[model samples]
Target: LWRVCFRRKLRPRQVTGDTTYGTVENIVAVEDAGIQAFFPLPDFDRRTPFFGKGTFTYDPGADAYRCPQGQLLPRRKTKYTEEEVLYQADSTTCNTCPVKAECTKSDHGRMVHRSFYADYLDKVQGYHETEAYQKAMRKRKVWVEPLFAEAKEWHGLRRLRLRGLLNANIQGLLIAAGQNLKRLLAAGRRHAPCGSLLALLREPWRLSAVYG
Candidate 1:
């Protein structure tokens, strides 16, 4: 949808979502599609570490990460199954470090994993810590949640009655139309001649025809 919008010159300024859509993959995807996305960091990524990955800094020159213990964790191997590169500390260095026990249980010292696109993922995490990202996330929670609640509770859109893509889309549009008509009527009632508003509310079916 975003791509289609972009091609049609209807580019969206930004997209915001909650934690569920905050995966590294999704954030990278959103950014790749040329939209700024605001999402909280995923729980797995946000876990407090024994010695956090931040303790290991990357060196582009050597293409390796330097551990807190001053040991260089060079690229050990790449996993074919997962698009990740693993870097490991020398066993001798880890075995000799006074804080080895605090750092890693591995015989080969400590290992850190980096995604092929870890740079993009890290960029997303960086943006997540910004004040603007936080404000956008709060707005997302405030605006999107109520519509889902309203659809489920009042419009019976909690379960689908229709099958197939076409029918399901039609049902969704109809549900949205119903919700919009309700909002319009409520607004009208607030300002319309008093008795007429009551009459309109008493006969909401008339709204279906007008909305359609």
Candidate 2:
């Protein structure tokens, strides 16, 4: 469906036992907000079975690719994609290729996905490699995550307040308000009684029960 409008208001994406609703939120504080808006990558290590082009082996010093026989395999041909650069081996040579059975089942020959953006992703990975994001994400554990265990384990509250949309909305608002109060009390921030409500609207997780 086409979106008639975009509202940053906290809309329920999922309701966990009248406790939480994960929301898509935006904060103006981030500098490169647009590019960093999306998920980073599908995986962590990112080294694929098909080596990315420009990807070096354990021994590039050896003139050729160390084939299964550990012999030097010549670079037969290179190819291009809409996305990135690529390289390939000779299909005719692959027919008699000793490691053909182990290397690939493809009668065509083994092909590798070459990404020009691999270095970009590597930098992003290196950012995560540091102690930073982990440290920041830890703040999420304080309230909402433990609140969930309390709701689920102690109260047996595993679902929403009511079936119809109106009832669900009411339940959500109440939970958000409760969470706001919890944060204000816990932090001892300089805030008046209504100030907590304002802060809840500013930060998303404040409206949800758990830190996660």
Candidate 3:
């Protein structure tokens, strides 16, 4: 239910700002990955401006990982960040890997970085192939698709609002805030009682205030 992102210099150093999109297939390839599955992200690779993607994986055991080509990649190394341990794969194993040609050609090999507190993403993934996730996806069609239309037709958000990262971030937050408001209002209509509306409304502030 939270969104977090990071930037890392991509491969083929020759091409700056380029990135590889992550997919459910790639994520499920880890051994002991414990993840179930993921909701599919649209494959929008216009490749014109900042094309990137992220896939959520289901972690059943809350350990290990699998690759896209049905390769089972294991978590091999752990690096500590002041607050948590970051589990990464050993580059050597990735280098000598036959699947390396398809996964990542990075000098460091095909490794995934997971924080000590990232187990939630794994659990979410575990629900990926579930009947629950499938039903949720169906509901999402009725949930998200139309909201996007509202943003475009009502909020004039059909096109990019500004150029570069600064503007994009602002625009995304504005859209997200609007979406939260809509969801909250709809909840009231359903007589669902107050839920995470207030907390979600304050989440950005809370995360900024604490995570930093």
All models, RMSD in angstroms: 6.0, 10.0, 15.0
lDDT of 3 by residue, 17-66 (tens): 10132243343332134323344433443432321213324244756655
- A best-first ranking of the candidates according to their lDDT comes to 1, 3, 2
TM-score of each: 0.74, 0.39, 0.33
Q: Which stretches of model 1 miss by more than 4 angstroms?
A: 3-9, 45-49, 153-164, 193-212
Candidate 2 lDDT over residue span 12-43, tens digit each? 32112111211122111111232221112344
By TM-score rank, best first, the candidates go 1, 2, 3
* Candidate number with greatest lDDT: 1
Looking at candidate 2, what is the lDDT of residue 122? 45
Clashing pairs in 2: 17-159, 144-209, 144-210, 144-211, 145-210, 145-211
* C-alpha lDDT of residue 120 in model 2: 46
| Alpha carbon lDDT at 78, candidate 1 | 96
- List the candidate 2 regions with Cα displacement exceeding 4 Å: 1-40, 44-82, 96-98, 137-175, 182-212
Residue-level error in angstroms, candidate 2, position 85: 3.6
Ten residues in a row with the worst lDDT in model 2? 22-31
TM-score of 3: 0.33
